[model samples]
Target: MGGLRNLSGLDASQLVIDGDLKISGNNNLESIADLNGVVITGTCMIANNPLCVGCTCGSIGLAAFTTSTTTTSTTSTTTVTTTTSTSTTSTTTRNPAYEGDVLCQSSAQLADAAALLEDRLRINGMVAFSNYDSFTCDVDATTLASMTAISHVEALEIRGSTALETLAGLEALAAVEFDVAIRGNAALSNLSGLDTLSSIGLDLTIRGNALLTSLSGLSSLTHVGGQLAIQSNPVLETLDFMTSLGSVDFLLISNNPLLTEVDALASLTSVNTLYVFGNDELANVNALRNVTIVGDCFISGLKDCVSPDACSCSDL
Candidate 1:
């Protein structure tokens, strides 16, 4: 059965399926624990159920089964395929190994790279791509859209792509286990693709993108475990999208020539070290009125500013 949008759970304790059993596209299904005694002799396919947080065959405590199944739970957006043999002695869960860094320097390699990432869901290493010298290749929107299935990565870097205008393909990317650096992508104007990214395990650096105008796509980002540096972007004008960011280990906003004010940082409550400098158009930092710094605070190069010993300043 599929497309049962309102069905929350299954409670058939003694259910048995002689043929294939497909349970899919159930948006609100949360538990299948009551199906613990279910017996299935054929393939069992469960996919696209968004709210099934931990509803797995093992989690359901299946009494007896002999079949192969591929389960894709949207809770974490990861796919797991398991095979149960007739011997009942062992159940082998197969997780394909797609390890190491992925580099796509040319357009020719983008399709294969995207396909590999889409199939694997997550990667153990970095994903870096740049069209620095390749006049025939560009990491554009379509190329990034093909990688929609990638939800997590150890690290990600998109740099120096002249034809890349926007980050429109990474809507499903929810987290970065480590750093995420977007730098020197000359034609890149806005971060529109990372709308769902809520956390970065380590640093996040946005630097030297010649045409970047705003931090628009990071509205869901709340935490940066390490540094959060926004530097040297000549045209970057605002941090308005950072309303959800509350804290970070270090916060640095420097050399953004057109940044006039930091009103977007009003939600920032904590930081280890805070540095705001070299922003030519910036006149005041009154927006940092409530930030509490545990380590150090340095403010300079604004039109008007005052150093507060305790890291709170309302008059700039």
Candidate 2:
């Protein structure tokens, strides 16, 4: 079934398809959870159904398909064949999951690092790179650009890279299963490379980047499962790129001296703890007036803005 504009459900669970299975371009399609037990003998194609959630063939327990690009978006495609079988046996071919940690500390290891990430699409452990005072080796954006095959990692830490100016290489990263910390990268300017990242399973901390000026790369972020902290980025000026962010657990916006407004938090409707303080230039926080917070809040250092009492759940 392809291009069926109103097709919203496919209950083919435990069914066997002898021919190629194609489900694509259904504009109103939403759920494919029922297709989890499907067995396809021929190739499978499921793509471009804008409203479909968790629609990937691999996500539904079918064999992983060969695709040039992989993203968390609904517009994903999969195509691969399976052998004919008489029994009701099933197997899932998931992307390779690396069990060991990956660390790329220098330029000499960049090629090896890229090759390792290219083969392991999912890393079950941490991926870290620390270039605090390494004058002998350089790990810049160009070094990270080679590792595009990595789609998911348990944790990611990039710290103190003087040569790293932008996150232009991590474009293929879609999700972080744990925390993500980017700190003390003095030359780093913006988050322009994390454009496709949609969710974070835990905390996200951006701290002490000397020249960083914007959060422009996180435009696709929709859900942050834990704390969202942006602190001590002296020149960081706005939260504007976080327009797509809808919910987070603890929201901490502290010490970003140049940050003047949080108007982009208008899309934020769900949060637990809210701590906005030490931002000397912060004046406009009218956006927090409509946010729904279920826990405590501590807000200060603003000249003329709504009080935390105004955002109390009791008022709602």
The most accurate candidate by TM-score is 1
What is the C-alpha lDDT profile of model 1 across 169-220, one tens digit per residue? 7888899999999988888888988999999999999999999998889999
Error of 2 at 53 (Å): 38
- What TM-score does model 2 achieve against the real structure? 0.65
lDDT of 2 by residue, 93-165 (tens): 3235556688877767767766666534578788877765663234677667765767888898888888888
In order, the Cα lDDT scores of the candidates are 0.73, 0.75
List where candidate 1 sits over 4 angstroms from the true fold.
Answer: 1-97, 106-108, 131-138, 305-316
Highest lDDT model number: 2
Error of 1 at 225 (Å): 0.9
